[model samples]
Target: MPRNPATTTRDALLAAAREEFAEHGIAGARVDRIAARAGVNKERIYGHFGNKEKLFDAVIKDALDEFAAVNTVLEDDPVAYVGEAFDRYREHPDLLRLLMWEALHHRSAALPDQSWRAERCGRKVRSLAARLGEEPSPDVGRAVLSLLGLAMMPLAMPQLAELLGAKMDTPESVAAMREHVMGFARAALEGRASASG
Candidate 1:
């Protein structure tokens, strides 16, 4: 079946809104700007999403869907999945910015998609624990968190990375850092030396 024009409009809105939220954050984002970027009337945003907060949530869901679509070799090698995840974040720094916005806006309140996000993360925690010959206990959970933090820290805190002299000014540096992340994860799991070795 042919794709509906409404779907096209919704996708355009999501793309436009992702950029808007990433740049301006929820408090700063404007509906008219999002609609203008999407090349649709602002009313469509209200019609399709009800409001700006809801639109921002939808953009996050769209990003989650995009990542889920890239579920490569996770079952075969969780370590390789870690490397792929690092690459994904490196390529989509805007997503990280959008997340920072979400964290800032919803610091105390529950996220709009809290339940769904928990369920999604729960699956990964379970998978990682099973791969390590254990249940999803606190230790395994912390390990999974470490893996994600290793991938995200550079993008999420580039100033810190720069201060630590881990700057990725070129492809070679990026590749080296990605390899270090994967190697560090593998080494941690295998009880071996650090990636620096």
Candidate 2:
């Protein structure tokens, strides 16, 4: 069945809100600018989402929901899952950077409860636990968390490498880092070394 135009309008507002929040933190994102970017009036945004803060929360949650929909974490192999997750982040750099920026600035707390995050994290945990063929372990969560951090943190915070006295942006540097991180992540998650002699 055909969808209502209101749904499209809401999606547009959410997309515009994401751009505004990602470009400028929540404190700087404005309803007028978001409305102009969406090609809708500010009143529509307010009427639909209530206010700027609520809209920002909705935008972030919507992005997260879309990402969760991809469900790449279903891979049974931890290394393959890490590689695929890295690819997803590589393809959608904005989402990773936006998340990083939010975390670094502690803006997530300003939005609403973190039950959403806990839920998302819980899903990953369940998927990983099944893959490992045993009960969920803290190591599983840590492995996934560390893998994502390794793959995304540098891109999310480009200055992180410079701060650590390394150039992490170049192709060679990036490739090397990816290899190291993936290898370490595989070993860490599987709790074993490669079988090569």
Candidate 3:
């Protein structure tokens, strides 16, 4: 089957825009550069996304969709779940950069597409709750946040790892850290489960 030319162009634009936005963020990303990289006219961006802010939103939505496809939280082996989440973040470095840019730009302001973001977050909380064998609640949501922090904090703050002489610069070192993080996370979950039980 043939794919639509419009879809192909949109995909190209999105791929190019992802790299541009990841490197420069929304305020710094240039439509001209994105178009040039995507090998399309800048007008196509306007035609497809309406404006720069809209394009950023599209990119964000696209990134989230990508995550949902590949970053499922596991119901079994919650510890392995944490390890896998860390692996996923390592695989998608730009995602963290995009999220950091969003946080810096939005501050306390509302997200570009608040409802959609909320839904995605809600789904993750539910998934985390399932891993704990509990119904979704505020406590489970907090656990979800903690587990995600465990996964991403290392990559997000690599300077601390380097300053402390932690082993994370190499692939083998990262794999070791991933196991440590998983163990750390599982201990937390076990402590809570024991206390509650």
TM-score of each: 0.89, 0.78, 0.90
On residues 1-197, what C-alpha lDDT tens digit does candidate 2 reach at each position?
98898999998998888888888877777889999999998999989999887887787787677667554564466665665666667677767756755665554343464876887787787787787664567866775578677666656666766788655667788667667667877777655333311
Per-residue lDDT over 88-178 for candidate 1, one digit per residue giving the tens place of the 0 to 100 score: 8888888778877877885567777889988887877888777776677777678778888787888788888889999988999899899
Off by over 4 Å in 1: 73-75, 107-109, 192-197
Clashing pairs for model 1 are none
**Can you rank all candidates by TM-score, best first?**
3, 1, 2
Instruction: Assess candidate 3 and give its TM-score to the true structure.
Output: 0.90
Clashes of 1: 0
Ranking by lDDT: 3, 1, 2
Please identify which of the two predictions, 2 or 3, would achieve the higher TM-score against the true structure: 3
lDDT of 2 at 83: 59
lDDT for each candidate structure: 0.83, 0.72, 0.84
TM-score of 2: 0.78
Give the per-residue lDDT digits (tens) of candidate 3, residues 1-197.
99999999999988999999999998899999999999999999999989888888888888878766653455656677688778878899998888788777764667777888888789877877876778989998888788888988898888998887774978889988898899999899999989978
True lDDT of residue 122, candidate 3:
91
